[model samples]
Target: MNTNFNKMMFFYTMMMGTLMSMSANNWLMIWIGMEISTTAIMPLIPNKNFLSSESTVKYFIIQSISSSMMMLGVLLLLINSKIEYQMILTSSMMMKMGVAPFHNWILEMTEGLELMTMFLILTFMKMAPLNMISYLTFKNNLFIILSLIMGSLFGLNQTSMRKMMCYSSIFNMGFIISSIQINSIWWTYLILYSMMLAMILYLMKKMKIYYINQMTLNENKMSLKMNIWLAMMAMGGMPPMIGFMLKLMVIQLMLINKEYLISTLMIMTSMLVMFYYLRMSFISIMFSSLMMKWSMWNTEKSSTWIIMFNLIAMPYIVMLKT
Candidate 1:
């Protein structure tokens, strides 16, 4: 009971901090809110193992440096109000969000965390930094390009599911950063991404899947395999999926703004991301254990829900497009 209460408190603190940062009008308040969220999340990182301990320490060190940079940038902006100060602040927030070039830490750290904790890091923990980033006037095209390139290139060879998700998060961050100017599209992409990620992680956690190879071990569970692959395809922005529609909106927004080059780059890198998602999906569906005769036809309620959720957005996509 005490442990559960403690966890609840930490979650409460984290939520309050994120809300504070998102709602703050001033730089100081933003920085304070970030600090609160960072501190609150620290307690939740460690899970009594060597890897978790290492991840916690790394998370702390990186966050401390990011917070310091943010504070320095805020102070400089207050005094001089230069573009460079804004750049520094923007870079700091990007670092906090684990955008590429500052992204290796997130991959390593995620490998050590429990699925739920990693899910929070990938989704909710990003909210404050994204909100902070939206307030910045300068948007660095170079970071967006680098994020897409690195996220795609690095993810192609990864075997671990955790690391793959980290890379996907990085790639998606590029899209999110590009669409930051349009609040409606940005929030919609985020919400859809979060939902897809939640479903994938939940299924992975339930099935005890940590790597791509482990997926083939569950030979009899076709329903679970179908659920995972469908989620992956949705996340990879396959045509007709909600994710594809979300990306389409972002691309359309970019085109309207005359950012043809970035839009093209986003499309190319998305295909790269889709390659690995297809690879995983194929492995889950095509590969099987030696004991084929022992296979059982079983389905879970969660699997049904997942499939329904993936398709339910189809009508909305049509409405949005028209």
Candidate 2:
């Protein structure tokens, strides 16, 4: 499945599709681009095992339905010349982005795929739909609130690392959408979230980790263990991290705009998410009491760069802000 040519083809084709969606001037081409990206990514979903194959099918069907809904919404707009159809279009794209309430497919799909592919799906595959979403008139505020609440509450008990991240993605999507109601903050949240997630993925890849149950924190060197912990903390949007700054900015925007109820809901739901992160961190520390060999941590040169980035990324961004 990792054939060089095939992988190259998938990468190129998906990029083409994403670029098409982003650059399209008209609605039709945008939808076409969306469909193309969807189709291109289907082959990339990794059908190497029975579970992966099932996940591929599930991914295909969910995407197809979401795309169809978007098309239907577009057609309604064309026929009726009504702003109401925009809601339909936006909701469909929200579903495509795995916003909560429509979030389970992404969780199931990520659970079934391998790590690199999961990273691709989580990051790259989301851009086109998100681009489309950003252009639509922003009236889906209720969906945004629901996505945050559901992502936080449901993620509380998740045992799998990937699933928790999926919920994290959903919760963050709410912030992304909320930022849409304001201006410019969405990009900040998205970039910081992606950066934090990239750090998590890098550590997991370096350690060949896919599950909480499979890997022990004590198995890695102390420094690397701390990186993973901090990465999780950052991803969970804890204080003194870049992710927290992103949330703080969003919250400030929300309060300034007098979205007091939304602000309160967000703050409360975020605590639920933070609780699970603490729970997971505690589990990792509790289970892995044995100290790993120090040599295991610095075995690769890449470790040096990731550690530097991990330690510096948030503080540097915070410094820039100041």
Candidate 3:
């Protein structure tokens, strides 16, 4: 009962804070909302077992620093009488979103967060801009570009699937941020990306993948190697997948906006990132043999079937839309 109470309180605080951050008219109010959210959840992270507790500590410290830095940015921006309240709010949002050089705190914070927590944080962070961008007057295309470039290149050799996904998520965030410069379609793009991510992470968790490398180890009776490879390929935005369609659509959006140089850079970086995905796939699928111990792996048949349906349906749905 106590656990349930804590969970409910955490959920309520986060939900309220998210709504407040999105709807607040001023920076001070948003800051308060963020603080409420932060404090409410900090205990939840540390209360978990083993590494999760350690991760929770690290996450709290890093987020505290980031929050301070963001507040500093807001104060600095506010010193200018010519800047509007919305301008200050936008700058704060950018810093919080970790778009680039402004993103100094994001990677470390991400490193400390557990996979499920990170996914939720990413989803929440993405929502802030969707609600706030309309009021922002400042554009930071350079920051967005830096985030994309760094996130893609740095994510190349991540051994842990969670870390890999975290960096990849950053890259995806960069694409969405860049799209904001192009049009309001950015919100739709972000929404679709978040939806896909939520589904993918949930499915991955259901498969008991605590790390990407675990996919190579056949603790389960099933041929995880092939399934893991398929999952990675889907994430790589390979053709005949929903991720591919999202990438193709966004890149075309970039091209149409005449961001030729940035577009080219994105394409090249995407290819580089794809190489790692293929590498993981090759190692997992090609090198590993199937396991014969079927009884040990007690994965739910119904859930697996549902995940399979979604995975297959995504591509067909895209084809229909196209």
Highest TM-score scorer: 1
Residue pairs whose backbone atoms clash in candidate 3: 161-212
Candidate 3 wrongly placed segments (more than 4 Å): 1-3, 47-54, 65-91, 102-112, 181-184, 203-208, 221-227, 291-322
> Could you give candidate 2's per-residue lDDT for residues 37-108 as a string of tens digits?
778777777656668888889988888898889888889977886557888888788788888778878887
Q: Ten consecutive residues with minimal summed lDDT in candidate 1?
A: 289-298
Supply the TM-score for candidate 1.
Answer: 0.94
Best by lDDT: 1
Could you give candidate 3's per-residue lDDT for residues 1-322 as a string of tens digits?
A: 1358777888688778878877799867777777777676665554334565666666567557656755765786668555454444555566556555555455555555555567766776457554555555566566557867877888886776666776777777767766665454566566656766665576566567655566666454344444555566666777665567667777887788888887888888888778887887776554445454443245456446534743775665466446
TM-score of each: 0.94, 0.89, 0.78
Q: Is candidate 1 or candidate 3 better by TM-score?
A: 1
Runs of candidate 1 exceeding 4 Å displacement: 1-3, 81-83, 289-298, 318-322
How good is model 3 by TM-score? 0.78
lDDT of 1 by residue, 164-244 (tens): 999999999999999887776788788889999999998888788889889878754677777888899999999778788
**Candidates sorted by TM-score, descending order?**
1, 2, 3
Between candidates 1 and 2, the TM-score winner: 1
